[model samples]
Target: MRGEELQELTLEELQHLERTLDVGLSRVIERKEQQIMERLNGLEQKGMQLLETNKKLREKVEELAEKQAVTDHPENVFNEDAHSSESGSLDCDDTSDTSLKLG
Candidate 1:
């Protein structure tokens, strides 16, 4: 079948050999296609899993940010009010000190 001693093969024998080779080639091609499809399916599943994980992580980050904002908002307001009151008292003290110095 490798072109060696092919002169000895009759037309019928060559035809049979050709048919056998064609059947073997078809099986090989079919198996290869099946394996490719399986690999593609595996990769697709992995991609979907990664997407789900990413979505969960994004949601967790957003939740944490919201919690942080809620917790920080009150502190910010408290600090501002505290600073304003302190500054107001300081201003009163400064005015009294200035009046005493002038007198």
Candidate 2:
């Protein structure tokens, strides 16, 4: 039918047309919402994976720092002469002269 002819419908017919349009629009909105939720779920999964990878890298960095501290010690680089006042030299200050008897 022509546009003018369809516009000239009675109020009851117009109400029926409005109800049909509402049903179709509601379905379209529902599908759009479902698609957005699926994309959000995928992003959350990727974020979790990134967090796990960051944690592993942090652990590796800590391990390397410990190894470097042992290999390149401060005493070796400074080249300060160490004098022994107590027997069985331990990593302690002169205030505490007690030696630990380690087997």
Candidate 3:
């Protein structure tokens, strides 16, 4: 077929060769499409898994942030109205105010 002795082949032989080539080409295209579909499915599954993992990580991060906020500000841990005496005694310390004034 590559410019090699094409004149020797009769018209019938050329037609047969063309049919064979067409069948082979069709099979090749089918196989290529199958592989592409498999790859696409794999990538889609991986993307879903990553999205789930990201969601879980985001939840964990929010949990940690909430814990950290509570830890950083301890006032939320207690209700002053319920423990008025304890809060009043704690207020006597006033250690949170660390300012110096000279007049």
The per-candidate count of clashes, in order, stands at: 0, 0, 0
The model with the greater TM-score, 2 or 3, is 3
Best by TM-score: 3
lDDT of 1 by residue, 1-103 (tens): 4658878889999999889989988999999999999999999999999999999999999999988977865533333544565455532334433332232
Q: Rank the candidates by TM-score, best first.
A: 3, 1, 2
**C-alpha lDDT score of every prediction, in listed order:** 0.78, 0.77, 0.83
Per-candidate TM-score against the hidden true structure:
0.63, 0.59, 0.71
Candidate number with greatest lDDT: 3
* lDDT value for model 3: 0.83
Q: Is candidate 1 or candidate 2 better by TM-score?
A: 1
Clashing residue pairs, backbone N/CA/C < 3 A, model 1 = none
Runs in model 2 lying further than 4 Å from the true structure: 1-6, 74-103
Give the distance in Å from residue 95's predicted Cα in candidate 2 to where it truly belongs. 9.3
Worst 10 residues of 2 by lDDT: 75-84
TM-score of model number 1: 0.63
